[model samples]
Target: MSRSLVIAPQWIGDAVMTQPLLRRLHARGERLTVGAVPWVAPVYRAMPQVEQVLEFPFQHGGLQWGARRRLGRELHGRFDTAYVLPNSLKSALLPFLASIPRRVGYLGEARVGLLTHRLKNPQDKPPMVAFYSALSGEREGLEQDRPVLRLDAREIDAALAAQGLRRGGYLVFAPGAEYGSSKRWPVEHYAALAASLQQPVLLLGSGKDTPVCEAIAAAAPNCRNLAGHTSLAQAFALIAAARAVVSNDSGLMHVAAAFGVPQVALFGSSSPLHTPPLNDAARVVWLKDDPGYQPPLDCAPCFARECPLGHHRCLRDVRPERVAGLVQGAVSSA
Candidate 1:
């Protein structure tokens, strides 16, 4: 049997987008193992096709030379091929050190010698999922088709009960973006949108987003904050059960897309074309020219730790009513 190991992306959204590649690999009849961070392990564990999951030690800080060497020794003789999804130079080092014969990944950072099969990134890849699917040797071209994520039925049921959600339909909103406040929509705006939802609003995010979710929930009594409560798998299950999801351009938005849930993804600083949600049912809302708004002087979208402009107009300018309208339309259509 052909044994293969695939290194998963660290971010939850990137991992969700890489599912098509995972499914493609599974169809090839290879014994598959996934290497992922502890936080994202729950998400991969839910994937039926994945046979094994190896955790990267937190002590390594992701690039500890000794840790990489030790992991390599343990992984030796385990797999014939390895596919790395992340572009970091360190990501390639683990499997390379493990001495996996065939290493596949995008031609990034001039690691041509390290990867045995390097595929050039596709041109004009609109949806992020299409770009990831191209990396799988089994898939020939960019598949513009909507991405799909399957969850265990039991888990979905448990998620619904945990959130008190029902089939009558509900909205899921994520107002946090881990990168920085620049990527996050205003909290008050999310509260306004939640109050307008036709059904109960389910708020989702990590521990960092607790404050935002709490404020939104307080403003809209019908809203429930599930931030810091659900595991990654539970988050996916919840998104799958929702009629629609309204979110800032973050990982949960990607999860909403993967589950084919209708979504309105608010974007600021980040370009929608580069990383739009991968669901056909989703639409991206970005700010256009407004006379009062001045262009961010310090190279906005620098993907920085903080917004250089004291005022985060990129996200602040997007009105709550507009987002609510989109949510209404998405849920109505569904």
Candidate 2:
């Protein structure tokens, strides 16, 4: 098998979307080892196609050239090819430094010469999953391929135990969106939904989400806030074991989709048409698609971190009752 190094994307959602691309490589007899920053490393562990995950020591922003060089030297002669996922110039630097015989990625951010085999950036943006899968140089089925992640049942059980959770006994409320408030459904809406549900609701996210999760937990006695308390591995196991999940268009939403857990994905300033949860079990709630939602959200999918219009009608218009109904149905059937 040809050994390959995958330079993973920095953002958690983007990292999860790359799974389909990795799968394509693994199917062709490529042994995959992923290079990821600390935060994204956990998701790669859940990918069965990946043989190893090398967590980079570099912090966010800047080149961190010396560190990259050291890691690249350590990886030298270990891989035959490198697939760089991000479009930024810095993302392609390690593979070039490592002297991997073949390096492939989309050309962008003036890193033209860094990659040995570069694909032109598509003029029109494509779904992130397809964008990454193209790095495999296989065009067929790119759009149809969905990301999948797996954890052994024992691992799932242990994670649940640590969180004081039982399999399929709780619902997950991932109310925080890393992109910004524009992508997050109203916190009050989440609390309202949890209050009406009989099942326990576990709020999960990064440290930044603690305040938001805590607020929701306070409003709903049925909700337990675990944000920033559990490792990403535990979070993954929790999503995998959830009876159903109610989440914004965030990384954990993608995680729930990958696990094939029943989910209600809320999209606001971001468009689901672009980064949708590519799972059969997911139901997307986007007001932009609802014609009856007057005056229609033409400004929707502004892709802004914050709503420019002051009123976030896109998500604000999507009532908690609607989301709660979907979750209730999902739980009943599951």
| Off by more than 4 A, model 2 | 332-334
lDDT at position 219, candidate 2: 91
lDDT of 2 by residue, 52-162 (tens): 999999888889999989988998999999999989999999999999999999999999889999899888757989998988999899989898999999989999988
Residue-level lDDT of model 1, residues 159-271, one tens digit each, is 78876677436778988998888888888888887777647888889999999899988888989888999887888888888888889888888878877788999988777
Cα error, candidate 2, residue 290 (Å):
0.6
lDDT of 1 at 64: 82
Best by lDDT: 2
Looking at model 2, the pairs that clash are none
Candidate 2: 10-residue stretch with minimal lDDT: 325-334
TM-score to true structure, per model: 0.87, 0.98
Q: What's the lDDT for residue 332 in model 1? A: 65
**CA lDDT for candidate 2:** 0.91
Best by TM-score: 2
Steric overlap count per candidate: 0, 0
